[model samples]
Target chain A: MEQRRKERIDRGVKVRSDSIYALMSWRELSYLTVPRLLLIIGMLILPLVVTSMYWQRVISIVCIYALLALSFDFLAHYTGLVSLGGAFFIGVGGYLTAIFNTTFGLPPLVSIPLATVFGAIICTVLLLPCLPLRGVYFAIVTLMYPLVFARIIEAMDILGGTDGIMGIDSFSNRWIEQYLVIIVVLLLLFGLRRLVNLDLGLIFRAVKDNDQAVRASGMSITNYKALAVLIASGMGCLGGACIVHIYMWTGLSLFALDFSILPIAATVIGGAGTLVGPVLGCLILVPISELLREFGTLRIVFYSIILVGFIVFRSEGIMVYGQRKYHQFERWIKV
Target chain B: MNKEPILQVRDVTKAFGGILALNRVSFDLYEGDILGIIGPNGSGKTTLVNSITGFIKLTSGKVMFRGKDITGRPAHKIADMGITRTFQIMRPYYSMLAYKNLVIPLFSPRAKRTGGWRGGGKLGDRDTVSIDILEEIGFERDSYVPYKLASTLPTGYLKRLELARCLALKPEMILCDEVFSGLSMSEIASMIPLIERLQMSGITLIMIEHRLRELFKVANRVMVLNFGEKLIEGLPEEVIADARVKEAYFGSEEAKEVMDHA
Candidate 1:
């Protein structure tokens, strides 16, 4: 009996340029650099290309979700810390920005950065006791934080209560609003790309692989885990700060469960581990959700169908599949 | 055997709830000696290794390594102090490539201080060092084997990779848990020479084996456990000839097999 199998191999240029000698040729260098540049340029032009005020705002929202998804990917995939705390981080940052803008009389630029930093510190400290546990224990605690915060604020009528903080500062202009997030996304995406290849990233990945072995290597897993949490929360809070500035108001809606759930769904649809895939997933998803706005509440049903379809057919996620295709070519070989 | 024991287990006991898995066991392992721990199933051989290496806390006991009490230290701390062990069930990182599995331990503080497997001066290129360790443990350095994901490797290679992982720490002692199990006759033959080579290179070894014949040949002393208590302890010949050992192992088919091997 004759048999054949599909074999995948890296392309000649990809394999040959596996090392840095690719610098010798413009073709090899461009092969490596073009895709990255295209993404950055495409994102920069997206708002202007759309020309609709509503959709331009959608681009900003997509970038915001992308930031949250990036934080989720870095935490769950790299450190084995599956945080359902996106809303917790978002709420904390949003509230802080609201407080800074209103009470402290800070401008949008200063307040957002202050909110990001202080909010991360607050999140980290509150999350410290839970750091020792992973998996569902961590997830439950994180998922509870937003609900807890919402309940506290509602009952006490603190931080503007259900009415929320009205008249928060807005971005100076729409251009700054769009480009600020767009530029930060590109920086963070590339920064994380580089970070994962560094020594610290290797340790983060090792923590995911076998934390017991990492411990055996004579390092503290708890400390590394804390660092990972800090980095992830910082990203999430930055997104939250951006949201407060864009909306020019803050309320209990900032603590909405959608803020928590959507980033995770985006991560799964785009790809779990690839930092950029979650961003791509958010870009695809938020737009679809907005388009399905015509269907009203049925938007959720269509969304679930798309999510379930992705999980059922391509559970490895789009980026993993796309990455394999881009880096390697497949051919049938006789066995 | 070299004088002054490298490791001493003084009345080590471990109990899980109401079950006493290790009942006040004691032994001494000198530098440059091979100790074989053998027993029937459920005799706590692996538990002893775990307790000593601090994978599990001892219910009551003391473990001394190089004359210092290391009873309750964590596994990694014990490993960092130059004592390393292979899992009875292999725990190689499945997602990583075979050689890449060594990257973490190769970059360990112990590896840096001790100069890793070859005991060189400066820690050279990690990838090259990883491939070199893999090659010494039966991997072909230039072949595609080292590049293969660890999960793809057969049991024999995985066992060798487990040993390779310990070697990456430049361990002074290697606690092997059934390393010879699930291997072909030829594979075991090749592996015997590797074990001898590691001992010759000045690392002490403790092997827990159900494969008594081969184990008895290399082990200078043998300790037998039955129902988590020491049954007999002596030279391998004396242990094999003991009436108590035969009687304790009576119902088990492994008894007749070991007698035939003897």
Candidate 2:
């Protein structure tokens, strides 16, 4: 009996030790999945493998937009709130970065984070009041923020108004621009993923399931929801700042409804809840949109059809569906 | 007999707009005692539980837990103060599996509902406590798999899972809201032993149950509510025998039928 009890105690200690190892391994796996790091390595190496600047630019823009869509996904999927003002933050980050960089002579590195901070502050102010409402009310309230943002930017001549921000400095080398944009994208992707897997993410999901339940658990649901929106908006703003760095222009057109709606639509199409889903959706859809530019008016029509197709057939979005399919495949392989 | 009560309610009242959900009511939850609360559909049993658990703001009166005034503290805060509750609706995280659903509350700082081994997802300090509780509650390591998808479980397992989730929070007291309302006879039978064991372990419990036989067998004291008012508070035998309690619950012959069935 003594020997058995001793063995039991030993087993218990081993079990706990094993779990600690598992938890650490899970965290390490998450860091490796960073999108920007993967993108950087891919961009640096792909030049040697493929040697096309146009494709590189195309991939770069696709990735930059992917970060924005991923941010929107974090809000819509994780928190269960939809916002149409993603572009509002994106525009805010880009224009502020432009003003700081061109007008005030701030370095790109400092100015970009500062621009995102400004966007986050603005988003928090907007998100706080809108939190009390649910469902379509939230959608309508958030939709208005972008419309108002565009009109405000258009009215301000210092922001370059309808013509947008031009004479923005680009990096001396295209390679630096490519690498910098890739780095930021990867950082936001991995950083946000880590944040989501933390305590805040669980609380956020708790709020998503039942606000009353989270309250019952002794947590304030509203605080976490607002935090999620602010974080997502901040990331969206950062993505916007990156966009301006590459394109070298901040315009009223940058904050258009398409900018707001497309990211959300792409997030939904990519798989709204999972981290990789929106990124993959961005990769797939942005290229399609660019390719359809030759179709002019017909591009919008085609986009609508694609949106409808995803809604009808792949309701969880392409990335989620693909993820589930892959998981199922893995399960089969194991069997 | 002279020991200070762990929980004290002094003429507490709650209103949903113009509707009086709970009238001026008073009760005590003594340390290490199982208190049974029973009422009809509109008898304000859930309302009383909600008010105590901080789901609904009380219109009037005061609730003191551990000699501290906890009148308007939020549900999570109240839970953190060694008070946890399970829902009549039993809101399980549907997207997550049973183990993951259980782990949510286990890993969460506010996991105070039921005790059981909350297996590996993310184990914090609270989760370590949850694991200990899970083991105490007779949840095997294999049972952790059920948490993978909580919504798919049989009703019996769901109740067990919720009970485990609550216990993981390490509450000094638990308020169970209709825990056995919708369960097979075997399920309820399985649950009674768990509750009995918790009571043995010296955890104070306030159970609002319609299952009179189980409530009578388990509760140290019984409190009956009628139309938002406390009709009687007494020992189980006395409360069960009381004519007023019978009238409030089942109107003579109907109550006799209930008694005969039990």
Candidate 3:
């Protein structure tokens, strides 16, 4: 009887798994259909249409900012941990790469990844102590990271004190830098989606939904939360490394609350947990923010209003709302 | 049919600061038997389940599972060792669909690591088991609507979803805390057949419920508790006839009427 029970259970698991695989295969095939293929092909060739250097510069800045927002969304939506120190890892990456390129005589290529890794490791370890905390307590503790980092950098003579690290080398070719930024943004988009779709990602979501349920299933809640923070910091650090290379300097100004809030705002505005939310948020907010930069002192105010508007109206953000709208349109067309 | 007990609890006690939740509780679960525990509100039935599942630290005594002392093993680790449980308040992931809730257990680290997937005979192929269990519980195989979002589900569906997820683990023993509470008569009746099927599948179950009629019908043996101590453990008919059991039930006039009718 026991043997028969085991055999029946095994067969049940196999059939369900086969069905899930079939669903994924169907999704993949549909994604590659004629109109979808054309749309994807058009998107891939968009940059070639623009000949102006001015457009290139604007696009690069937008990509970098979007990267920052995407990382924040990964933490907030995927793991259900609201961390306010979004810029801390970015600041570390930028500052470290700048310092390495200028003082240590390193190429931008070598310095960027190294700086990102260094920043990621530091933040990952530092965030470990706060893993046991939850809710606003976790958020408040992490919020102090950027503030404390800024104070320490300012007080230290080696980091040029309050003046910050500066005069780092820009990319040798401007076009190369622009393409590099776009590529990084695309990679982050792909990576974020892949992470959310993985078994580990599902575990993180399970933790978010019900920590006690996750624990009873024989998984460590603390470990999973810590891992989420680590991955978020890693993405932030990578974006920061690229931004430093594009702008050629890093300062305490880059690590401010505005930088931190930008990602949170973008993530919220775009849609928190959905695959395309942060990227869409960045696509919309980054261009507007870049345009409003001409307004000087009023730029932050304008961004804040936009963010508040997003929060007040579409609380789930752009992607979620857009997805529903898209579905409605499809249904209407079908009818 | 006599066999050695698979689980033995010796003088187990738990206290929250100064208040005693369980006092010198001792019981045994047989290798392959359905045990029913019935009690009034706050009689420490759930507390006993919690202690066995390692959700709470015991103030005194030890619990041995499969002859190995497993006192204070932590909830997840205890679950890892082939003992799974459900809450009095159901805990299905609200954002996930009904089927996806079952997937969590099927992919549970303990279940997966124990050879539940390839059937190295470690955890014992939980994924395939879960799908079959879902079918047995009367969940439609082709219907994807039920797997959409748990938060949108009716109360009856939620209870079944919780049970389906627990069954996904293919546990050696299942500790169900008040599985029938808050469920409608129809809902309770539907679950009876599923419970019967699970028994037929050779899974040992320990259910705590307030529904005495269902308990009496389903359980081969019944245990009653009052004020954190075991009042009686015997065949349901014998326990119902006990004077102590009737006295405990007499605390409520409605229960007295029900007892007289019985």
Worst 10 residues of 1 chain A by lDDT: A212-221
Q: Which ranges of candidate 3 are over 4 A from the true structure?
A: A1-58, A96-106, A156-160, A166-169, A313-316, A330-335, B1-4, B114-130, B142-148, B249-252, B260-262
The candidate maximizing TM-score is 1
User: Model 2: how far is B206 from its true place, Å?
Assistant: 1.3
DockQ of 2: 0.34
Model 3 chain A scores worst on lDDT over the 10 consecutive residues at A1-10
Ranking the candidates on lDDT from highest down gives 1, 3, 2
Clashes of each: 1, 27, 7
- Model 2, residue B48: distance off in Å is 1.1
Real contacts recovered, all predictions:
0.42, 0.45, 0.62
Per-residue lDDT tens digits for candidate 2, residues A1-335, read 22322111223223333443534554444433443455556645643464577777777777667777877777776787877777777787888889998989887777888988987888788679889687778888888887887887667655677888787876668777677766666677778788877756766776677667666555567778888888888887887887887788888877777777777777878887877777777777888988899999999999889989989988988766654543333211211
lDDT of candidate model 3 versus the reference: 0.76
Judged by DockQ cut-offs, the docking class of candidate 2 is acceptable
Q: Write the per-residue lDDT of candidate 3 for residues B97-192, one digit (tens) a residue.
A: 666666666677766765442234465333345555566567776686455688987777777776766665657788888888898888888889
Please give the interface root mean square deviation for model 3, in Å. Answer: 1.4
